[model samples]
Target: MNQTFDVQGMSCGHCERAVTQAVKALDAAARVRVDLATGKVQVETDQPREAVARAIAQEGYQVAAA
Candidate 1:
């Protein structure tokens, strides 16, 4: 499934990496794209939306409710 999340507090490349890593940790094959300027995170994975959101949250970024 493809999911788009509204995230906050991402201000740098490291932040993007962190968010991407967080999602990948849940699914190695998952694809993650982060846009700092818009705080948008686009992910393609088999994982559920909540699970993906949790992973991102665990990385310390706020995942806004969809």
Candidate 2:
């Protein structure tokens, strides 16, 4: 599934990597793309949306309604 999430508090490349890593930790094959300027994250994975959101949140980012 392809999902887009509205995230907050991502300010730089490090933040992007953190979010991507957090998601990938849950699903190694998952593809994660973060747009810092837009505070959005695009992910392609088989995991449930809630799981994906939670993982991102666990990375210290806030996940807003998509």
For TM-score, the strongest prediction is: 2
**Per-residue CA lDDT of candidate 1, range 17-50, in tens?**
9999888989999999888999999999999999
Candidate RMSDs in Å, in order, are: 0.9, 0.7
Candidate 1, clashing residue pairs? none
lDDT (10s digit) by residue, model 2, range 1-66: 999999999999999999999999999999998889999899999999999999999988889757
Candidate 2 CA-lDDT value: 0.93
TM-scores vs. true structure, each candidate: 0.94, 0.95
Model 2 TM-score on a 0 to 1 scale: 0.95
Q: Which structure among the candidates has the greatest lDDT?
A: 2
